[model samples]
Target: MRIRLTDVAKGRRDEALPPTSLAYASGEARLALAETEQRPTVLGLIASGRMAPDVGTVTIDGRADAATLRRAVALVDAPDVCDPAPNVTVAGMVAEELMFAGRPSNPVSARRWLEAEGFGAIARTPVADVSPRERVALLLGLTALRPGVEGMVLVSPDRHGGHPAEWWELAESFADRGFAMLVVAGEAAAIVLEGRAPRADAAAGTGTAAEELDDLVAGSGGETPAALDSDLVDDSEAEPATATAGDVAADPAARDGSAPASAAEPAPEPAPAPTTDPAPARSGEHDPIPESADPDPTPEPDDRDEPEGDR
Candidate 1:
């Protein structure tokens, strides 16, 4: 998928570039390379047909009927494969996608294809009931099943599949079936890159574009994807308890809004608590020990028998 990033990130100059060119092309490639937690989602429309630079044309076979160029490459357009209306069954939707892509036509053959990709069970289910990943996974499997596809392009495949082995096995299985692969990941996760093509570099420059947009949005004004990297500042690894206010106060450049106070600033102290000992109830008016100015006074014992003897 080719995503056009906006102004939101500006501080990703410290990121690393990849070793391939196609890595830079499939759209999400650059984001996969960026080490920073900060990033944007401006990946431009996917041009999956074949990277034709001179023709000024980028065609994506992953799109829906080729009306718009903004479709994702991998399972990008796969999630929306089924119609929202009850016009078609979930299995029927899968079959239609296969047929449109020129896969097998008859339902029996299509079901067999679905069975191989672990999709036979949910085939008749409504498209609305299926989870997002399930839909995407079906498409991922379909790409694997479809014969003569030659090479396949995947956009942000990592979002749907977490472990590298889960998708890698599929790619290996597909390659054994004679299909090429292109995978788009959120990060430059090499383990997932196992079976993909004459690999291309994850566009390191894309991170720069994202960073510049991020910084611009953060500095002046304009909408952009939230800075993923800056938000990472809160992690225990980046922040310490002993981090005095001075460290935060020193940098005006870093503070987009109001700067924090310096160490010289007075800190509010904690209030003291009342003691466990209880106080006496209110007396007549003023109750005090005669001839006593001290706060703590000793009480004298009553002598009723001595008073009676004196009388």
Candidate 2:
């Protein structure tokens, strides 16, 4: 808990400094929207013990060393930083993460923990089968299980399903558990942190003060011109066949010498074809007329069988 970054700057030496400066305390969830390429580097450096901020200080509980910070912070489900292989099972991912974090890496223990957390249904299933939202949730839960993990920095958790607010809610839940939570994403997700909207000053956009990197990333170098009505004419109206010289001369307007100065008089629309009624069918064409069920035209009355003499 109690993570702070004072004028922190991190990025490749050849490139410009990343906009990663800010101070954040425990029980607070902040959103950092860094450039796509630089995002992973910044999150990885903060989570891992590899690199420290170039410009200022990164202190957790008043300690600034990489080893101490690494033990305290965890990065969850960040493919660019550290993600389990697609084929890895849920249990396998947990075991791997625990092992790297210097915690218990027992697969059986990991599986039991996952089952206890209601992941038993997908414990054996591959991580790829898990939905994005479920996967992020599982990963965050796994990060929390790591020994001495006091803080978590989620990279692009909003890339999964559900609204960004939901993701922020999940992060806030972690902060409630006495862990410092920081979420980084491509854009500022609508979040109500600490019962209030994100402060205007808290936003450290991916770009520097002099330039807005969003414009570059969004592929808008400058203001785009609006299209004119003529530029947007329907294809059906604009694609009429060109009039031949003979046809042009035969136009009624051309004959009367009243045609416009332009040689291209609009082609007259073709007249609608007249419709003819279908011919009537003969009486016995293909089907046979239905006949009466009884065929006898004349029937003699039956004599009483009992009276031979009378017959």
Best by lDDT: 2
lDDT of 1 by residue, 1-311 (tens): 23221121222341322222232232222223233222111121222432222212232321122333322233333223322344456677777767756777678877787787677888788765665566555665665444434445545445444565555455545446444444445544554454543234433333464554444454434554356445545564665445346755776743556555556568998665456853553543234345656645555644532444332
The 10-residue segment with the lowest total lDDT in model 2: 209-218
What TM-score fits each model? Answer: 0.36, 0.55
Residues 1-311, candidate 2: write the lDDT tens digits: 44556565665662434545543445666665555655555655654455666667665544566777677777666656576788988888878866765777798878877888888888888987887667877778877877887877777665655566667777778878887777766543534333443531264333242232222322232432233224435543777655577976878876676754554667778775455853454453433324755645675654433344431
